[model samples]
Target: MSDPHYLREAEKYESPIPSREHILSFIQKRPKSKRQLFELLSIEDEQKKAFERRLRAMVRDKQLSCNKNGVYRPFSNRGLISGTVIANPKGFGFVSLDKGGKDLRLSSQQMKLVFHGDKVKVRLLNRKLDAEIVQVTQTVKTLVGRLNINQDECYVVVDDRRIKHEIDIVELIEGCADNQVVVVEVLNSPTLEKNASGRITSIIGNYLDEGVEVDSAIHRHEIPAIFGDKALEESAKLPNKVLTKDKKGRVDITHLELVTIDGEDSRDFDDAVYAIPSKNGWKLMVAIADVSHYVKEGSQLDAESLERGNSVYFPHRVVPMLPESISNGLCSLNPELERLCMVCEMEIDSLGSLLEYKFYSAVMLSHARLTYTEVNEMLENKKSKLRKKYKKIENNIDFLYGLYQTLRISRQKRGVMDFDRIESQILFDDQGKIENIVARKRNDAHRLIEECMLMANQAAAKYLQKENEDFLYRVHPKPTPEKVEITRQFLTAIDLRLDGGLEPESSDFAKLLKNASGREDENIIKTVVLRTMKQATYTPNNEGHFGLAFEDYAHFTSPIRRYPDLLVHRAIKRALSNKHRERSNKMVELGAHLSMTERRADDASRDVEQWLKCEYMRDKVGECFNGVISGVAGFGLFVELTEIFVEGLISVRDLKEDYFIYDDVHHQLKGQRGGRIYRLGDLIKVKVASVNLDDRKIEFVPVSK
Candidate 1:
């Protein structure tokens, strides 16, 4: 027992204590404590940690188990892996592993025993990591969906398509009818032998009601919408206008002539900026609304804000993170009104290098609430009426523009990657229906504001890092090796090369974009490169941002809308006031939750927008339109209409007269016999073939000239 497999373990690890095989075999008949195992294995003080680690490895690999009392035994479910089931709408699923790796694939039959979002333990069914659900550790308690009644039977067709099962309606809500949306409480979860069942808890409304799509998505994503009673009461007692008492212990920057630049229909303005020429370079100040000052720690408002994570914006309405009294009233940096703000003041050199920076609480007066169009016109067109009207602050605007240009040069030199992607704006009619979808163009004013915010964010990150405080940073990790390789293959086929070898820097990506500047497939190249990048997330660990090429970065602006920004504000205040005090221990958990909620908001918004787009295109079946191949996959090509901005799929099966082979690396489908390639960024004419509102999909067919 003491020496079995000892030589093999020694070969695999240096200073090996005990082999996993020996540990598992020793505890097979009876559970043993760590002390007993240590004594039995004759482990020295130096080898004690190694022996404990071997036990943990055995537990992780499902060879042994450790209970709450610190006793270990042979694992009952030896080969099962714990994970969360992520089911697809096509009757397949994947188990997102708890320890993290490639997901285990689950086929239709294997997925029958569990639903989407179920915490489960699975056993590997094949060598390909295909798995079968052995047991469900947790099941979803309720589902939001449309109630369907067929003659004598009833079921709920879930709003989340990823949940492929229709819950049998064993109990129904009174007055609920066909095609009505409702929430169903799960009375029974599916098993290998029995189907899932639920009872209707609440009836929302008719499926065709105006704006029901947004409402359904809100419930489907479990977004916190209504404020709690306590939070509302607290918000009601707050002052609508800035009070003199609130101005205490704050610097008065009311004479700075700061301006708030935003979209025409924007609300809840959170940041204002002003700049002036300095001896060396320029002095820039970014004042963000002090949201944390009003929402105190452990207060009701803070709890509500944490639950929301961030504000969810829709085309017609917004689900604010804080109550209206805070987000839109007291904290909004409205023009002609004094407001409390946390100011980031930076001293820089002529080349836009930061020399020093400081943060302080201040009272600011926004002289003008400017729109991007107005500012752009003011700078470019001196003869415009708007330019002459806002002439009082013309000098301030000029200085800010100068600062932006300098910062932009520094950014380029630092190898910041810029993706030239087109974003669509939905134009609504008087009745709130989408009239048309058009591309949105970004002008210099947009980049001007972005640069200022980026500077402030980076400064805050550096300050906190230097002070050694615990907080969240906006982090973007480098692209994976697999993605980099795929991008390399695609770049090579186009006669382009990605430098920096396996671990390419952002400069390499910038160089590729610059080389592709005048080409027809420029946007497509940008798109491919963009897809190769990973999504930026929040983390307590400062890994830096790859996209912006910043050495330190945190989201310091938009505290009224984002929770992490609020957290940053609190951390900064704490660091400035008491350097010796420790930061909150919940930063890690908050980072993960805030990141997840941000994604949740984005997905919910996208879901509603896609549904509306489907409705808009429903009447245009058989109409011919020109589109660009925006995406390519094995099943089909996603084509975005040039004028309308709607996207539809051209199925591979519809390509008659030849068999098409998909090349994912090149993002193209090549016809075997005809030798024609349809790839990303290729222009083509198509006709709307069909529309599926339930699936939020539009189908297209190729058209000949």
Candidate 2:
């Protein structure tokens, strides 16, 4: 008696809701033809299949949009495409259209019609894969991470490893417990079946506390790390030093004895240097720390330093990109006192080339903050104390160690690769735990302050490309030929080749790391030509850098802690004063979303420092370590170890003396019954066996026979 075809299609449709306008006026017309929408509302073909089930349940609850050649349309005649969801770790998500091309995918059951940073309209259902979603609109929320709980329910999970969804946790905040992390907030969001309801909003700790690996790496890189009260009242109106009347007309360079160098328990000095011995030879200088002139450019301390696009550091703490009344007191360059910087001033020659450059705006004075083990004991010991503490910068740190041996011989005659990888550095202790890992030794004052910050970031990328400026740069490029034929079939099964061919040149991977220098398979073929290079981002264009070959590069020496080196210090103060400043198209869409959230905060701080170095070797589980076969794939092999540099895995069902398989052109794994192989620089031994830390993974095995 009721569904008389929605009462004869509500008596032939006309009440465009007229009880004195009860508002539902979405009228750019269009909607008629599911049989011409039940025969233009005239219903009755046996109540026209209940008036096509009340107009396909008002176009599946979005009140209207039947667009896949099924006509009907009307949600104010739809058409608005702003994308970015890409979900597939199956809670179904796919949007990626911020106006580029194609990319639409959708389907967590046709995206129960949209969630996950939603701002959709998507019409082309499939004009040969132009796929789309959110017919009208929904998810404008749901993304705050790290939860997992589990007692009276919990899940929230998303530290955006590309939105792989977990979501669920329905309201709870009493210091939420089980693996205690927290910070949820979502509230109803999934798509194929009820899930996305959250709450907890920050408990952030307990799972391995005490700076819980820096509050779980600033809550898995959502990175804000406290500082609002209008960014600590605009960092309490800045100023802590730099004065002599704000250094009367800039550039004093404090008698250019600039020093700094870093890391011996670094505390924010943000670059400094100085060189000398010129006349067809060396001048150098550098400087830095002006942090976009006390963090300006849309303040609340530049919106908490653009929501932390930099300064994370982790193992034991340092979230800071700004607060410490400006990154450790009015932008630290700390030492003698008056700071302010920005410099550069080059002019090298003894073949480190450059021979000219400028840039200015200064007022420096660091003169000794030294470290990298006291400039590698004053350049490999000349009876150290950095030569009786400075003695007027010991002939400018020995002409900056002969301009870092003429910029490591014009960076190995312009090819560069030298990847003797093994970095390490964990240590910790006084209650923060991890007491030792080691490796970090790069001496000669860390290659003379890394060749004077790569000659002041290739002279600030050729001084902002001779003023045709637009910023960011840094690049890297050159790897793919399928990762150089998977690094030439894993260095031709260790016989090792890399002698310029098969696209080699980075000085033929620096002459195959100087012929595998002092081998032990030299960290297994320099971690296999560093997993065949290319990962140095930040772009505005100039590609160059293939591991520092540099036609131009940038990161103008740190700008306190990198937001693309404070947009290369406001594009080197608008190209040293031609000053147009304009910028904002939402600052080039937030400089490509802060360079993809600083490469997802450096891959979630190297995945929580490889899950806290596999929970600091989970009490050395069954020992055995030597390791190597660093990855082969058909579901397992990986390994790595060699004195606690952890890495785990193995699992080709524990390679129990047979059935191995996965060769894919010899990156290894062979065995199908004792043809025994394993590959990627073999060396095996394994042992660790288990440490998931909720799938940050680790597990090894094969030591038996």
Candidate 3:
């Protein structure tokens, strides 16, 4: 026999008399109790049960809310706002509003029924910014966590620390062991009385296994690790080499000497450059791989590429946007191989100003594949064996160096701010464990290539804007007044000042950075300025880039790795074909999604790096190292070790001296009794106290000298 509840639900679906829309419309007109609604609609005894079921469904969907007096009304009529909940590690949560305001605070008790990333309607409580969840509109379906089995009972603890609830496993898969990472599919959501339940669908591996830390981050961020069958099939069908027919409309520049310069371990080559002295100044050609020539729009490969947005580069691993067949094989500009490309040819005057430029499809052959180290060595040692060996293209390299110097002068004149921060590179052993961490160095060759790319990107952006083509712009807004004020106060504390009125330009920042160079507090000042600036994003609306001091900017290089570059190529192609295309609203949506994916990749990579660093520091407990104060907060100071480039927190409680007070305006902590000060960029000595692998954190304590 069927249950009465199931029968009633089935009956409601069959009959269309009291539809969801009808009930919503009726309640929206005016608030009414169930009896009033039933009487107003002239419901008979038999229809009463069906009407009640429909109303209940409406309430569950968050279309309506029922008051304690049994009165029903539209949710919007009662000041309820819908938002996505962001859970905190401490069991509380915040609801991020869609309209973009301050996040509404949710108490721990109010967050018990909902999971992280759940969409819910919330109503303001007595507090101005505090809210309580009225109803959940959507729930998370799956999560990645570590499995724990106690006797006959099993549960999975989610990797996201903010989600404080452990999912009770109802049906466990075979061979699942304790402390193993696994993916859980939610079977039932939590109620007022019970916790959420789930089933283990897949086991990743033991938490301590080699490369498992990165794997866990991949799952935690829900990054697509493998391509779909259709996408792979499409990639497999791509040609290994450019066909004769494919070069029909392309200008042949293979006779010109072009070279590719990248890192020693780089496998994918997306750009090649050529330079020569012209009558007026210099003629520069930048050839980028034509990825869109092979991957057509609306295809499976395009779909997958758009979803990935950009390649995520880890220390030794790379999750490429496109498959190797396309990114590294067919589209890569390998040496001595004829490849199709989109070229940006520019004529620059003696002042390094771009006088004129043109874009065209071209076929080119890379004469030599060089590394930054080799190029820098050749430039530094003119008469070296390596320079003599590559003498055929030595003149072109010299010309590039001259052009780079000119462009750098122009860039400085434009007041571009450059931060000289050190980035650490991780080295691994044969067993895939961390061996050491070293600083990655950048030289003139790197800057020369960057200037060339920037010129090409600017040309593309200007050309597209003139053609009135719809495309994405790389926009970076200036810092807000509040942030600027904070920066001003911090600079004053360091005995420096930032001019340029309320809205200072990039050149002003450049001057201040110049003044701070070689000072004891250079790194601290740079960090503060960088923090004050807003993050750059992609948008259809052109707001200009604040960091580079460019009036217009768009990503036009490395289409093999970035989807925005691919879209720029497509837009350029459309404009070349003389097609009058209007901007579609879909492009706006795509810009937002691509920006989100970019941030997602950054967060995942940072998580993996932190985990690996923690692992590297695990064996060095109690070892003392000289470090610099990288950050200061109310809780403690963050120190970055000088030798290993590892960072760890020195908690305030661990000071064990005079009580310290945090000075937010000065970005420092001062002892109330002893008057001891610990400011940013101060040299200090610290000892590693502990490492928590589960939390991906390192703790340190001050070492008395």
**RMSD of each predicted structure:** 9.0, 25.2, 9.7
Pairwise lDDT winner, candidates 1 and 2: 1
lDDT of 1 by residue, 307-333 (tens): 999999877789999998888899999
Question: What order do candidates take by TM-score, descending?
Answer: 3, 1, 2
Cα lDDT of model 2 by residue, 1-705, tens digit: 123234444576653211101112322355454665444444455655554565555655556555546665555444656675555544666677777865767766666555555666665432333444545455644354566665566676665444655777767776576666666766666655666676777686766776555565565556677777887877787667765676766877677788888887778888888888778888888888888877888877776777787777766566777777667767788888878888888888888879788987888888788777877777777887658877777777878888899888888888787775787778878887788877776777787888889888888888887786777777778887778887887677677677666566577787777878887768767877887887777767777887777888888888677777888888788877888554335545665767777776776678777777878888887777787776778988887877767777878987777888888667888887668787776788878877866556778898864
The lDDT per prediction is 0.88, 0.72, 0.88
Per-candidate TM vs. native? Answer: 0.88, 0.32, 0.88
**Cα-lDDT of candidate 1:** 0.88
**lDDT value for model 3:** 0.88
Q: After superposition, how far is residue 686 of candidate 3 from its true place, in Å?
A: 0.6
Give the per-residue lDDT of model 3 (tens digit) for 369-445. 99999999988988879888888888878999989998888899889898866778899999999999999889999
What TM-score, to 2 decimals, does candidate 1 have? Answer: 0.88
The candidate 2 region of ten consecutive residues with least summed lDDT is 15-24
